[model samples]
Target chain A: MTTVHTAASAVSAVSAASAAEEKVDTCASEAAHPPPVARGGYTISEVVSHTGLSAHTLRWYERIGLMPNVSRSHTGQRRYSEADLGWLSLVGKLRLTGMPVADMVRYAELVREGEHTFAERQHLLTRHRENVRQHIAELQDTLAVLDFKIEHYADARRASERV
Target chain B: MTTVHTAASAVSAVSAASAAEEKVDTCASEAAHPPPVARGGYTISEVVSHTGLSAHTLRWYERIGLMPNVSRSHTGQRRYSEADLGWLSLVGKLRLTGMPVADMVRYAELVREGEHTFAERQHLLTRHRENVRQHIAELQDTLAVLDFKIEHYADARRASERV
Candidate 1:
């Protein structure tokens, strides 16, 4: 009935922590960038690699207003800034929590409006935080059910071996 | 810095516990029924209400082999037994875990094979259990980030009031 959370899953947990650290809302000044790029911004492929979001998803995020006013290169290619990566990392977290895209776009809109929306942002995230906790509790219940069934199978296996 | 989990979400937790109790795999002999319906079968609508799955989804579950061999009534209406309700309950929990439908259909096939597949079922569930735990851990990380930002908002609100 006991299942070990393996090293592979642990690595994902570690990465999730780093992603959390990248959350840009509180301190845009602390945004981490790689060495200065050709035009001082990340290319689409670089963002895709760093965020593990598809190039299509990055473009779509911008199109849908999830990523607002992304700077363009001299030739008009998308050039993501360090702050953009931070917001994308946080968006990835909310997406994992299954926050609807419409809500995320609203949240992004608030982000763009700046300081005045902090209270509203707090309320929105608090509501969503509650949702995520309920979601975790449900998954835990599923784990219990799985454990019970696994134990039943184990018992049956032991009985069959004795036969 | 502090958020109440709230009575609304608390009620959902209570229901999830009962839903887990409805899980049918471990003790089919203990399947609960709502006073015996006509022909000892639940109508599709009744199962829909009991399981909170849409009629379309219930049928699709059958179509995808996630629900195997649901008996039909004389007029070709779906006849759900107490055991079927139990299976649906378990299936709903797994669905909440976001287990891939293809894997769930395979799990249903294993369930239909019965005792001989117990070991395989154990292995399958063990793998999924690990996945669910990893998911829960990621959600917790998200919660931590939300908490940090919420606290930052609280600070801003406090400072703005002093002006």
Candidate 2:
């Protein structure tokens, strides 16, 4: 009876060990598939292709110090981490919103200095959003002008046909 | 009857002349309303306040030869005509669409030479539209990433609350 009881305990121990091993394997897999925040990094060429900005513009952006100090490979090629891409993606938005490059450089400077300028950054972004809103309004107006021109030509064509 | 008819005809002719003169007065009033597109033209300062572009940028655009030469005032200040404003409006569109100032200068040269380069102008504008389209796509993607990040932070907040 004592021998049987000891065997039962040993078997349960082995099963627990197997279960623990399985749990570790699951954890390993989970580590490999981290959330969005866990992206390893990206290279400059990758960034250029992804962002659709020219290599020259990228270099120019760095030269103007609009970009943060980027890491480099042993070969001296710029290496970008996920954080860098996140920052650049914001820069892209600012550029699209028509913030001048000079103004963007100033904004970048503020960003590099850290969270003390959060209010300033937020203010700048809010101002830019307003500007973009105004720009879209202007674009809508011009688009109406274009529509009128198109209709004018179409009407003239119809009139010529009638003649 | 002939004398009566002659008098009546003279009176009719005078009435018709007066009607024509009234039409001319209406045209003249309309012309004077805007002063025939300001033949005396605008100074650099006037263009600045009118267009909301900086005076320095306007001069730089001219100096870079992206803008057509404007007539100079007797005091040698730059005088811009209505046509210049129209052209500048086009330039603003190109600039807003992310065409480099240098490329715009080339385009301006093509334009100054007249209608022979219509195809080239179309090509340039078409290419720029493509660029803008690509930029828009990239911005959409970046916006998605930003949304993701913002959501992640929100989720983290929720998770902390659960904890």
Best by DockQ: 1
Docking class of 2: incorrect
Total clashing pairs in model 2: 0
Which candidate tops TM-score? 1
lDDT of 1 at B163: 91
Compose the digit string of candidate 1's lDDT tens values, residues A1-163.
1212223332343345355453434333334553424455779987766666678978998899998988887789987766676677677777766788888999999988999998899999999988888888789978888999999999999999999
Error of 2 at A15 (Å): 44
Scoring model 1 with DockQ, what do you get?
0.42
Candidate 2 lDDT over A65-134, as tens digits, reads 9986877776787776555655565665555544677878988898688756655665665565555554
What DockQ would you assign to candidate 2?
Answer: 0.05
Candidate 1 structure, TM-score to reference: 0.79
lDDT of 1 by residue, B1-113 (tens): 01112233333443554556543343234446434343547788876666556689889999989988788877898888767766777766776777777878889999898
TM-score of each: 0.79, 0.50
Over 4 Å off, model 2:
A1-163, B1-39, B144-163
**Per-prediction DockQ:** 0.42, 0.05
